[model samples]
Target: MADLELLDKSIRRVPDFPKPGILFYDITSVFVNPEAFKYCIDKMVEIYKDSEIEAIAGVDSRGFLFAAPLAEKLGIPMVLIRKKGKLPGDTYSCKYALEYGTAEVEVHKADVEKGKKYLVVDDLIATGGTLVAARNLIEQGGGKVTDFFGVIGLPELNYEKVLAPSKITTLINYSGK
Candidate 1:
């Protein structure tokens, strides 16, 4: 099994962030620790090195951090899935519901080529709304989503079920926060 206690400890938890009664798991703390950051990338590489992934599609901002390095290490291309209006070309967008409200995400239509295999990367997976949106965007562009990768997974929300039939890999999991 992949042990991530050190990386887990590196994450900072803030209660009621951006709103009341909501706990946020901030990953910026892990970025400050070189060992922890490298460990995360290393573990992700170890898991997917044999999967013949042709490209990595990182889910907006935070996912970019993890996907860029991993794409370089694996010698694959990186695609960006960003918030609506962030991309500057023809794009495909998907709207999904969030815990608080509804949100939309998009990706450049040309970035994902037909039949290409892509792995979606993000810092964490909570309700999985974003991941689902990202996947739909990729599929709309004719790309296949091989799996979903995350540094942390909040299982209390049952994201695993929400993303059923799609594989998910996370370094550490926290239950019943």
Candidate 2:
């Protein structure tokens, strides 16, 4: 198979998922492929290795899955941006509108350090609302977001609207129907 075809085959796509028109691109298939999963992380590391990121902040839920291994490999701390009230101690939060409604994400105040560079990780980027909220919280805590990385991206969603002043990296990009 061609390289692109091979890579796409390993990702499972669920149609009309989470809503009537959403197509969820799932990466569980990659978890079963050691080489593919390793390639995924290696690519991310290569891109951000020289970015001098002191911390990797992962958005709640799926973001944790990617940040854990990446942080271990890079030997940096990993902070969780969780759902409101999920974090212990002093926290900062940002609320945004989701596809259906509104939601809030939080991060501990102590997890971020002044003048430190950070990378935000999430499963995918649709409209970029969630990641933007996470980035705002990081910057509010004195951390700078060097880049936003994800496994998949919905190019049609116009991430630039939310990430206007920043850029993002993704292993795969899709313009779903």
TM-score of each: 0.95, 0.92
Of candidate 2, the 10-residue stretch with the lowest lDDT total is 1-10
**lDDT for 142 (candidate 1):** 94
Badly placed stretches (over 4 Å) of model 2 are 1-6
lDDT of each: 0.91, 0.85
lDDT of 2 by residue, 14-83 (tens): 8988877778888788778776777777877777777778899998888887888899988899999999
lDDT of 2 at 82: 96
Candidate 1: global Cα-lDDT?
A: 0.91
Best by lDDT: 1
- Alpha-carbon RMSD, candidate 2: 1.7
Clashing residue pairs, backbone N/CA/C < 3 A, model 2: none
Clashes of 1: 0
**Model 1 worst lDDT window (10 residues):** 1-10
Scored by Cα lDDT, where does model 2 land? 0.85
